[model samples]
Target: METQSMLVVPVGEETEFNVYVSTQWPTLIQEAVAETLDIQSSRVTCHVKRLGGAFGGKVIKTSILASITSVAAWKTNRAVRCVLERGEDMLITGGRHPVLGKYKVGFMTDGRIVAADFHYYANAGCFVDESVLISEKILLHLDNAYNIPNLRGFSVACRTNLPSNTAFRGFGVPQGVLVVENMINDVAMALGCPADQIREINMYTGPSVTHYKFEFSPDNLQRCWEECKLKSEYGIRREAVDQFNQHNRWKKRGISIIPIKYGIAFAEGFLNQAAALVHIYKDGSVLVSHGGTEMGQGIHTKMQQIASRELHIPTTKIYISETSTNTVPNTCPSAASFGTDANGMAVKNACEILYQRLEPIRLKNPTGSWESWVKEAFFEKISLSSTGFYRGHDLYMDWDKMKGQPYSYFTFGVCCSEVELDCLTGDYRTVRTDIVVDIGRSLNPSVDIGQIEGAFTQGLGLYTLEELKYSPTGLLYTRGPSQYKIPAVCDMPLQFNVYLLSDSNNPHAIYSSKGIGEPTLFLGSSIFFAIKDAVAAARSDSGLMGPFTFDSPATPERACLACSSPFIQKIPASQPGSFTAWALDI
Candidate 1:
């Protein structure tokens, strides 16, 4: 008997954790602090910087990066940079968990949803991290504004051979929302309904009822749809698409209007917690530090606005500091679009407390020396501190029974999209998108609009044009700019529409300002459906509409296979298998 060479397998060996992580922890930014020390508000500057682009990349994952870097820096006793290569980044980074969703939606022919059942299967890679949270968001937004009598929705987590995924743009809402929204599109198509017409009939367009104790606002979705349809030229575009598809028999086009009813604050009310410290110097300058990190979403800028509003000081007198544990301790991750909502409140409240102490001094010496006013106010004041948390309101919840209103308030809107596809190469383009959102009010419209556009574009890439490759050894092959694909300037749609509800502010939000972060990404799912419609039309298949839903980051090759060329290729469907289709050929 010939002795075969013995093969050795390593056991329990933790490979060097070549991990690159991100976090939304830093609220009191040092840059904001330094600026406040200089000219403060006259220039109205915010010291902001970002480590990367796209979703989960800027959220809680930064905590991992910080922790790892801290450990390396401590051990080396020198500046140690542990930047993982692209493959390592992909292997270690969390992403949009591909989801499988099934729903049975029942509605009266008039458009009121009476009964519905939602089943969500989330692919939690290697661990149950954000799956449950995403599911909660899914349940919260179920029926999406419509008052439904009997509704049951459940989510399950499935372990797979992949990296543990975390929050992306919409926290966990996008994954769950895509599943529900897709069902809506299918239902409309089955019933021969127009997208906008169906939304008018079903969405929470009626008088609002608070699900939990949080005040529910009755923002008009019906009006929003009308404004967007006309502004976006949705009807005209639809007709044009039909004509284009008719002339070009080889390719087709499709359009869809989707509604997103995202809730504000963290999924867990405790996650809504925030802390801040506001300091007023003898020079009348203020230092503001709170628990929220700025990754170019203008959080620091908004916090300044919050402080100014509360303190009655010019935007120039305030300075925000770096988000270090030393400033505001045990902070929540800034992924829930609540950076300003939570930390800004804490900052503003802190300033108000400080100002109340100074009020007597300022009034007493209307003509007194500025130095004297400072001396009296600083010495007589108690330590200045304020903390705010969005713990669920008890008046709205049956705590023991877990039955009642859960969200503080609902942020409602609908996105309409039109797209064209190529028959020869299975490529597609987003010709236009119209988004109508009720953001309550924009403390800064420029910043809010930028977030909306940025998030939407990133989501478009996730669902329509991005892909991550993995080796059988549980390694990701695609990483960094060279290998990974993101949207560029040329990929933007020809027509874009963004409308913010002008007269309203979120009653429960800090100062009535609503969050426009994560919801921006979920709207891209609307575009994905439109593209899916175009593909289906080109393929001319009706049965494919029911179940064959594709997960996103849909690169050209994947899109081709998903839309056309269903090559009868058999992949070894089993656990402990490399999830790379391209490698299978090798």
Candidate 2:
């Protein structure tokens, strides 16, 4: 509690009180105390710096922290700093929900998936927060890159007293992808087929009308698989691994190729809008603003490219600022990978407006120079200001009906992971990872490549090693860096490769470039499937298990438990008293 929290001070009287420090927001603690209690919301202003590698941890909580700092400044008439310690951040904030999931898939004898049914139960921490949305998205992404005729998915939300689970890099896609990938592996092992043979039968071919009723091309998913397999010599390497595994006992090898067909918009309807402002200055400089948070994912950099392309100006001449609601009113949260797709579409639209205003001037003066045309247009159009909004595709559909193109387009990627596991210890290492993404067009090849690398690595962390742990009292015990482990640099694969399936003239976007953020992150489960294959190889020569469990963060301890026989365990780890409930029946 801050001591300076007072309404008024009389002219004749002296006021004295000690001011205690306030805590930061979204760092784990939900609410914030003012730096000075005397501060009023009306007189307060919030300040925000650049975002670091947030890993999707900053959201609703960050705003509350800013408000607290602003209040502290208002009351004390001095800037008060409240930096959050990692322990407090973790304890107060919700982590990923430990989900109990079941997946069953039926496919043709040739490996073409016919139908899929998935059941996902989420322990939605202490608060509802974003758990329901996550569950919905998992259901939506049941068929990551394959065409399934009949599919059914449902979720039950369980409320726990613990801190509410929130969004992460892969959001809900990884969970969904892993379930289906495991199902595929189960079938392949039963049918005695190589991973590639199964993929070739199931990979998307033509336009598909999904269960949600949108017509999309799944060719990129197959294209990514083809492009990456050829480059990485998947056939040759897989043979090498199989032969090598035959010779080795302690170190066994496994390889698999995965496809990701990620939806590039918010699952919720209300969050499907992005706003942008583009202004061409008098001296040929351009300023652009869009509603995509830059947690170091290159949202600003991408926006600059979009603005430059629209205005026919050099990218260097364009400047983008931090995403602020005040400047770009009624903007959507940058949660969706559509940072470049949605916001970039809006910025591109705004730049088109500015271009229209300047076109007449350019026509009259006949200036071949873009700078000159922009300068003339600015003077003629009364300052060259325009605002644009990305309201999804050109189609019109009822939101409640849930039957329109939710995303402008989909992003595609393929992850081929090779894992070597020690059947004794249940420890595994990613021997190789090959990835290819159809970014439509590469506005910046290096930037797009970096995005793919970062997203895939983050996905690896979620599936291979990162997860949240808590105690029974609904208190989060995995607080701070020590208990909460993420993938380290040394944990990376020995062989990593990336290929972009881009033609530079994407008819869909500013530069025909697609969003690459979450698409690459869903491969966490794909890689895990390969690891599961290795584990199954050691235990049984018969067939893969029905499902490999949501062994995400497939830690050595959990993997060992999954493979090693236990005492007839029937409890669900996500639910409290699940084991007890099972015992009562027994």
Q: lDDT value for candidate 2?
A: 0.66
Task: Please provide, for model 1 over 1-586, each residue's C-alpha lDDT reduced to its tens digit, 9 standing for 90 to 100.
Answer: 0110111111122312222223444422222222323422222112223334435554444445545454553345444445555555666667776667788888776655577798877777888767666666666666565566677777777788778876666756777767666666666666666655656666664566533333354555666667677777788888887788778755667787777777766646666777887776777677777767666788888888888888777888778756545556656777667777777777766777766766788897877664566677767764444443333223233545546655556676778888777755667777888898878777899999898888788778777767666665756666666777778886777888788866775667777778888777878877788877776665554235433555554455555666643331233335654553553211
Most lDDT-accurate candidate:
2
User: Candidate 2, residues 335-450: lDDT per residue as tens digits?
Assistant: 66766777778888998888877767777887467767766665565557889988865533343565666556788877788888876677888888888788887767888788
The estimated TM-scores of all candidates read 0.80, 0.82
Question: Clashes in model 2: which pairs?
Answer: 5-37, 27-89, 28-92, 28-93, 126-162, 506-512
Candidate 2 Cα misplacement greater than 4 A, ranges: 1-49, 67-78, 267-270, 360-381, 394-404, 504-506, 541-550, 560-586
lDDT of each candidate versus the true structure: 0.64, 0.66
